[model samples]
Target: MGGDQAPQMVVAGLRQAQKLHPNISFLLYGQEKLLSKLIPSDDPLRAITQIRHTDEVVTSETTVSTALRSLKKSSMRLAIQAVADGEAQGVVSAGNTGAYMALSKLTLRAIEGIDRPAIAALLPTVRGLCVVLDLGANVEATTENLVQFAFMGSLFARYVLGIEKPSVGLLNVGVEELKGHDKLKMAQLVLKNNPLIENFYGFIEGDDIAFGKTDVVVTDGFTGNIALKAIEGTAKLLSNFLKQEIQKSFLSKVGALLAKSAFSTVKHRLDPHRYNGAPFLGLKGIAVKSHGGTSAYGFSSAINVAVHLIENKVNERLAKDISLLSQHLVQEMENLSLAIEKPTPIKG
Candidate 1:
C-alpha cells in the first residue's frame, strides 16, 4: 500500500527469498485480493507462504494511533502479532513507517530495559558498515535516552554485526566536546560515565558518518533524519552528475566506456538497494522495516536482513542485555528516590 510498486515488488522479493532460503516461511499480510493478483497460480511458493488478509490499509492520511485503533484486524497489526505469538520470527513491511512503529510498539512492546525504541539503519562505509540509530523514531529524546541508545547500539554492533566492542560516537556539529546542542552536551557527559559502552569514541560530525569514524553513531530523530536524507540526496546527485558528465562528448563517452566497470562497482557499493531495510530495535520480535521507495532488489535485500536477524536471535539477545542494564538503572533511581524522601535520618 505504501511503496510505489507495493505487492508487485513484495511478491518478487518473496520469490527471490524463497529461492535463497527455502526453509524460511513468510506470512504475507495485506489485502488478499491484491496479493492474489500478484501471486502466481500453481506456484510452489504457495506451499511455504500464508496470507493473512485485512480490510484496512494504512496510508499517509492515517494517524499512527488512529490506524492502530481503527484497524485492529489490519494486516500490519496481524503481522506484528504473529511475531509476538511466536507464529513468525519477524515482520517486514514497506508501508507507512509511523504506522508500523506504532503497531509494533503496541503489539510486541519494547524490551524491558529500553526507554524508547530506536530505528537503526546500516550505512556502508569504506571500512565496512556503521549502524546509525534513532533514525526518526523519537523526535525528542532526553540525555538519558541518548546514553541508552549508545549502549543498545553497541550491543547490536557486537552481536548482530559481529563487531567486538564496537566504537560508539555522538553525532554532533563538530569533533569538539562543546559543539552540539545542550542535549548532546549532556549526553556526552552521560556516555562518558557509562562503563557499559566501552568504546565510547567521543563526538563525531556529519562528515565522519561515511568515513566510518565509529561503528555506531547515536542521535535524536530530528538530527539523525536530516543526516540520513542529506546522505541519500548526495548519493543520488553524484550518480546523476556522473551520468551527465559521461554523455557530454565523444572523448568523454570513450572515457566512460573505459570507466564503466569501475562505475558499476561504485554504483553497487553505494546502492541503497543493497542496504534497504532497518530494524526497529527494542521490540520483542524482529521487525525489519523497508523503505517506501524500495524496489524488488531493495525488498530482497531486506528479506536477507530479516533472515539474518532471525537466525541471530537479535531481539531476544537485545532483550536480555537491555533488561539487565534497565534493572540496574531502576534500582539506582529507587535508591536516589529514597534518599530524597528520607527525613535526613532524624538528624543523626
Candidate 2:
C-alpha cells in the first residue's frame, strides 16, 4: 500500500513478466475488488493472475508481532504463507520493507545456521556484477554473523552471478588490516582462517564498491545501507546534471541528439531499473523486495531476479553451505576451548 503506484505498477509488471516468461504465474494478494477495477475486464491476465483477498492490509507502521497477530486476513501475511505452504515459489513486493521482512522471517523462518537473514543486492561494476550483503536487513551484527554472510554471499556470486571462486572482501573504513572497528577485525580473523572461504580478499573501502575490486563485499546492515543509498543518490544527481547540461543551448541539444545512442547505452548501464530487486538471503524460501518507487520495468527486473534465484536454488544452496561451515567452526572453536582448558601435565 505504501508503494508509489501500488496495484497499477504491480499489474503492469505482471503483464510484462507474463510476456517475458510464460511459465511464471502470479498470485496477487490484496483487495480483490480494487485490483479487479485496475485490471481490464477482458484481459487474458485475469485467467493467469489469481487474487487472494484479505480483509486487512499491513501498513508500514504495523509492528512485526502486530502484523503476525493480525494475519487472520492480511495480504502480506497471506503472500508469505503461500511460499511457506508450497503454493508459490517466491514472494515479491514493493510494499513496506519492514513489514515484509518481518512477515517473511516469521512465516518461512530462517535457514539453518543463519542468525538473521540479510538483504543481498547486486551492483553492476566495470568488471561485472558485485554482490553486497547485509544491505539493511540487520543493523547491528556480530563477527560470526559477518563471517556467515561471506559464506552465503560467496555462494550467491558463484551460482547466481556465475562467478567461480568469487573474491570476498570485508567492507571497512580502510584497506589495511589495522583499520576498521573491532567487529571487522574479528570477522577478518575468521575469514582468514576458514579454508572454505575462497578468494578471501582482506578489506575494501567504500571507493572500491563501484570500481569492482572484489566480487563480494561483506558488511553490517548499517554501513552497507548507507553506502548503497549514497551510491544511488550520486547516480541520480549525475544523471540530472547531465540532462540539465545537455539542454542548456541549441548546439548542446544538437550534440545531445548526436550522442543519443551513446547516452542511451550509458543510461541503461547506470539505471537502477536494470537491477531493481534485492533478495533476502538466508531464508528458507526466496523473497525479493523491490524498490518502493519501482515502475513496470523495475518490477519486471525483480521478477527476473526471483526466477534466477528459484532456478538456481539459491536458498537451499545457502542453507547447505552455511550449515557445513557453521558446524566446522563450532567444532574448531570447541577443540580450541578444550585445548586451552587443559593444563600442562608435567610443566610444574
Candidate 3:
C-alpha cells in the first residue's frame, strides 16, 4: 500500500514470489478490498495468503517521526510489528525507506552488540555479486561502526551469496593504507588484527567496486549512498548509449539483430531487478526494503532475499560472530596490559 502503485505492484509481486516458493505463506497488510480484487478468488495463492486489512499507509512524504508516533495502523508499521511478535519470519516493503528504517529499529531493535543497523544490498560485479553496507542507514560511522559493518557484510555475503569465505574491503579514497581518514585507518587496523574476518583486503577505491575487488565492501552511509546512486546513473547512461548507437544506422541495426542473443545475456546479468532487496543488517528481526519504483519481478526478488536469509540463519550466525569478536578484543586488551606492566629487560 505504500509503493508508487500501491496494492497493485504488491499483489503482482506476491504472485510471482508464490510461484517460486509454493510452501511459503504470505501475510498481506493493506486495504483488503483493494488487495483482494488484485488476487482472484480461485488463485492458488489465496489458499496460503492472508490479508490483515490496513487502511493507513506511510506515504513518500510521511515523516519518520510521524510514522513512528502517529501511524501505528499503517501497513509498514503493522508488518514490522508482526515480525517483532514472532508471527512472521521476515517483512518486505517498497515503502518510505526512512519511515521503514525508523519503525523497524523502534520495534525490532538492533542486535546485541550492534551499535547501529546498516542497510546492505547486493550489487552486480564482474566477479558475480558483492554485498555493500551502510547504504544510507547512518550518515556517519565511527571506526568501531565501520569494523562492525565489515563483519556483518562478510557474514551476509557468505550466507546469502553462498560464498564459502568472503573477502572484506573497506571503501576509501585510494587503495593505499595512509589515504583515508583516521576512522578508516583505525578500522583497517582493527580488521587486520581480527582473526574472524580471515580475508580483510585492506582498502578499495570506487572503481574497484565494479571490478569486485572483494566480496564485501564497507563504508559510511554518506559515501555508500552517493556511490550507489552514481553507479546506478552510470549503468543507465551506458544502457542508453548502447541503444542510441544501435539505432543510429541501418548497418548497426543489422549487427544488433545478429547479436540479440548475446545482448539478452548481458541484459539479464546486469538487470537491477535481479538485485532488488536491501536488507537492514544488524537488526534483531529480518526486514527487507525494495526499490519503490521497481517492477513486480524486482519486488519478488526482494521477497526471495528475505526467504533466503531466513533459510541460511544469517542473523543467528551474525550474533555469534559479534559475541566471539567482542570476547577476543577484551582478551587482547588484557594481554596488552600485562605485557606493558612487565617491563622489558634493561639493555638486553
Candidate 4:
C-alpha cells in the first residue's frame, strides 16, 4: 500500500511471485476490498493466502517517529507484526523505508549480540554477484557495528549467493593497513582474526565493488548509501549514453541491431529489478525492504528475497555466527574504548 504502484502493483507482483515460488503461500496485508479485487476468489493462490486488512498505510511523506507513534493499523506495521507474532516467517515491504526500519526495530528488536541491523542487498558485478551491507540503515557505524555487518554480509553471500567460501572485505579508501579511519582499522583486526570469517581480504577501494574483488563489502550507512546511488546512476548513464550514440549514426544503429541480443543480456544483467530486495540483517526476525519506485517484477524479486531468507533460516544462521564472534566482538569494543579514553603522552 505504500509503494509508488501501491495495491495494483503489489497484487500483480504477488501473483507473479506465486508463479515463481509455487511451494510457498502468501498473506496479504492491506485494504481487503482492494486486495480482494486483485486476487479473484477463484484464484488457486488465493486459497492459500489470508489478508489481514488495515485501513492505514505508512506513506512516503510520513516521518518515521510519527509513523511509529500513530500508525497502529498501517499495512507495514501489521505485516511486521505478523512476523513478530509467529504468524509469518518473514515480512517484505516496498513502503516507507524509515517507517519500516523503525517499526521493525521497535517490534522485532536486534538479535542478541547485534547492536543494530544493517541493510544488505545483492548486487551484480562484472564477475558475478556481490553483497553489500549497511545501505542506509545506520548513518554511523561503530567498530562493533561494522564487524557485525561483515559477519551478516558473509552469511548472506554464502547462503543466498552460494559462494562456498565467501571472501570478506572492509570497504575502505585503500587496501593497505594504515589508510582507514580508526573504526575501520579496529574492525579490520577483528575480521582478520576471526576464523569464522573466511578469506578475509584486508580492505577494498570503491572500484573493487564492481569487479567483485570480494563477495561481501562492509561499510557504514553513509558511505554504503552513496556508493549504492553512484552504482545506480552510473548504470543508467552508460545505458543512456550508449543508446544515444547508437542512434546518432545508421552504421552504429545497424551494429546495435546486430548485437541486440548481447545488449539485451547486458541490460537485464544491470537492471535494478534483478536485485530489488534488501534484507535488514541482524534483526531477530526476517524483514526485507524493496525499492519504493520498483515495478511489479521488482516487487516479485523482493518477495523472492524474503522466501530465500525464510527457507534458509538466515536469522538463525546470523545468530550462530554472531555467537561465534562474540568473544572477538567484546574484546574489540573494549580495546577501542580504552584507546579512546587513554591519553597520549606529551611529545618530547
Candidate 5:
C-alpha cells in the first residue's frame, strides 16, 4: 500500500515471491477489501497469506518527521512493529525511504556495537556482484563509521554474494593514499592495520565500481548516492543509444534482429530490477527497502533479499564480529589521532 502502485503491485509481487518460496508465509497489511480481491481463491499465496487491514499509509511526499510523529499506525510502521515484536522474521517495503528507515530504526533499534546502520545493496559488476554500502543512509560518516561499514559490507558480500574472502575498498576521488579527505585516509589506515579485516583494497575510484575492483565498496552516503545515480544514468544512456543505433537504418535493424538473443542477455544483465532490495545493515531486525517505482518482479526480488538475510543469520555473525573488532578499531583511531597531533618535523 506504500508504493507507487499500491496494493495491486504489492500483491502481484507477493504472488511471484510465493512461487519462489512456497514455504514462506505473509502477513499483508492494507485495506482488506482491496487486497482480498487481488488474490483469487486458487492462488497459492492466499493459503499462506493473512491480511491485517489498515487504512493508514505513508505517502511518498510525507515528511520523515511527520511520519514518525503521527503515522504510528501506518502499514509501514505496523509491519516493522511486527518484526520488532518477533511476530515476523523480516519486513520489506517500497515506501517512503526516509520514513521506512526511521521507523525501522526506532522500532527495531540498532544492533549492539553499531552506532548507525548503513544501507547496503548488491550491484551488478564485471566480476559479478559488489556489495556497496551507505547508499544514502548517512549523508556524512566518521572514520569509525566507515570502518564499521567495511566490516559489515564484507560480511554481507560473504554471506549474500558468496564471496569467501571479500575484498573491501573505500570509494574515493583517486586510489592514491593522499587523495581523499581525512575520514577516508584514516579509514584506509585502520582497515590496513586491523588484522581482523582481510583483503583491504586501499581506495577505489568511481570507475572501479563497474570494474569490480573489490567485492565490497564502502563510502559515506553523500558520495555513494551520487555515484549510484550516475551509474544508473549511464546505463540508461547506453541502452537508449543502442536502441537508437539499431533503428537508424534497415541494415542496422536487420543486424539487431540477427543478434536479438545477445541483446536480450545484455539487457537482462543490466536490469536494475535484478538488484532491487537495499537492506539497512547493522539493525537489530531485518528491514529491506525496495525502490518505490519498481514493478512486481522487482518487489519480489526485495522479498528474496530479506529472506536470504534471515536464512543466513547475518545479524548474529555481524554482532560477534563487531565485538571482536571494537578494541582494534579504538586503538587504530588513537594512533591516527596521535599522528595528526604530533607530526615529525621534516628536515630539508
Candidate 6:
C-alpha cells in the first residue's frame, strides 16, 4: 500500500524470499480485494501467508504526525505492532520511511544505553562491500551518539555481514584527526580509546567508502544521506552514459554484444538492489526498510536482510557490545574522579 508497486511487487518479492527461508511465514496487512487479485490461491506464499486487510497506508506526502495520530490500522504500523506484541520476529516495509522510523521509535523504542537509532546500510566496494550508517535518521548527532553508532555499526557488520573484528572509521573530510568538526574529533578519540573498538580507523574520506578502506563508516544523517544519494546517482549516470556511448555506432554495438557478459558482471556488482535493505540499528526489535521504488528482486533482498539479522541475533550482540562500551566509560570517569580528588602538591 505504501510503495509505488505495492501488492504486486510485495507478493512477488515475498515469493522469492520464501524460497530462501522456507521456515518463515508472513502476515501481510493490506487491502484484501487487491491482494487477493495479486496473490494466486495456488501460489506457494498462499500456503504460508496470512492476509490482514486494512485500507490505511502512508504515502510519500504522509506526515509523521498524521501517521501517529490517525493511522493506527495502517499496514506499516500494524506490521511493526506485530513485532512489539511478540507476534513476529521481525518486520520489512517499503512504505513511507519517515513514518516507519517514527512509528518504530514510538513502539519498539531504542535499545537501552543507545541514545538514538541510525539507519545502517551496505554499499558495494572494491573489497566486496562495507556498512554505512546514519542514513537520514537524526540529521545531527552528538559525539556520544556517534560513538554509540560506531559500536552499533561494528556489531552490524560483524553479525549481519559476517565480518570478524570489523574495522570502524569516522567519515570526515580528511584522514587527519584535526580536520573535521569538534564532535568528530571527540568521537574519534572515544573510538580510539574504547577497548571494544580497537580496530578503529581514525578518519576516512568519501572515496574510502567505495574503496572499502574500513568495514563500517559512521557519520551524521545529514552527510550520510547526501553521500548515499550521490553514490547512487553517480552509478546511474555512469550506467546510462555507457549504454548511450555503446549504441553510438554499429561497431560499438557489436562490441557491446560481444562483451555482454562482462557488462553483466559490472551491472550485478554495482546494483543497489543487491543491497536494498537498511537496518535501523540500535533498536530492540528488528525493522528493515526497503527502497519504495525498487523491484521484486530488490525487495526480496531486503527481506533476506531482515531474516539474516533476526537469525544471527544481531541485536543481542549489539546489546552486549554496548554494555562493554558503557563499562569502559564508567571506568574512565571513575579514574578521572580519583585524579580530581588527589591531594595537591601545595605549589611545590
- Which numbered prediction scores highest in TM-score against the true structure? 5
lDDT of 6 by residue, 1-348 (tens): 357888799888998999989798998889988887777788778888888899888887999999999988889999999999989889999888889999999999998889899998999999988999999889998877898889888888888889989999999886343478877766766677788886998789999999999999999999999999999999999989999998899999999999999999999998888999999888889999999998899999999999989999998888877877877766754554475469621111
lDDT of each: 0.82, 0.84, 0.88, 0.87, 0.89, 0.87
In the range 240-314, model 3's lDDT, one tens digit per residue, is 999999999999999999999999998899899999999999999999999998889999999999998999999
Q: What is the Å distance of residue 167 in model 2 from its true position? A: 1.3
lDDT of 2 at 212: 96
- Listing every candidate in turn, what is its Cα RMSD in Å to the true structure after a full C-alpha superposition? 5.0, 4.2, 3.9, 2.9, 2.1, 4.0
Query: Residue 259, candidate 1: how far off, in angstroms?
Result: 0.8
Q: Which ten residues in a row have the lowest lDDT in candidate 1?
A: 339-348
Model 5 C-alpha lDDT per residue in residues 1-348, reported as the tens digit of each score:
478987788888988998899789998898888887887677778899988998888999989998899987899999999999999999999999999999989999998888889999889999999989999989999988999999999888888878899999999885344577877778888899888778899888999999999999999988998899899999999989999988899999999999999989988998888899999999999999998888899999999999989999999899888987888898888877787778722111
TM-score of 2: 0.91
Any runs in candidate 1 off by more than 4 Å, and if so which? 175-178, 327-348
Please write out the lDDT profile of model 1 over residues 135-242, one tens digit for every residue. Answer: 999998886688778877887788778999999999987545357676676566556656677889988989899999999999998888889999999989988898
lDDT of 4 by residue, 1-348 (tens): 468988788777888888988787777898899888878899876887897788888899999978899878888998898899999898889998889999999999999989989998889988899999999989999988998898999889888888889999999885354567877877877777778887899789999999989999999999999999999999889888998999999999999999999999988988898899999998889999989899889989998998888888888988887876888778766765676578621111
List TM-scores for all candidates, in order.
0.90, 0.91, 0.93, 0.93, 0.96, 0.94
**How many steric overlaps does candidate 3 have?**
0
Local distance difference test, candidate 3: 0.88
Error of 1 at 343 (Å): 27
- lDDT order of candidates, top first: 5, 3, 6, 4, 2, 1
Better of 1 and 5 by TM-score: 5
Model 5: worst 10 consecutive residues (lDDT sum):
339-348
Cand. 2 Cα-lDDT: 0.84
lDDT of 1 at 216: 98
Model 6 global lDDT (CA atoms, 0 to 1):
0.87
- When 2 and 6 are scored with TM-score, the better candidate is 6
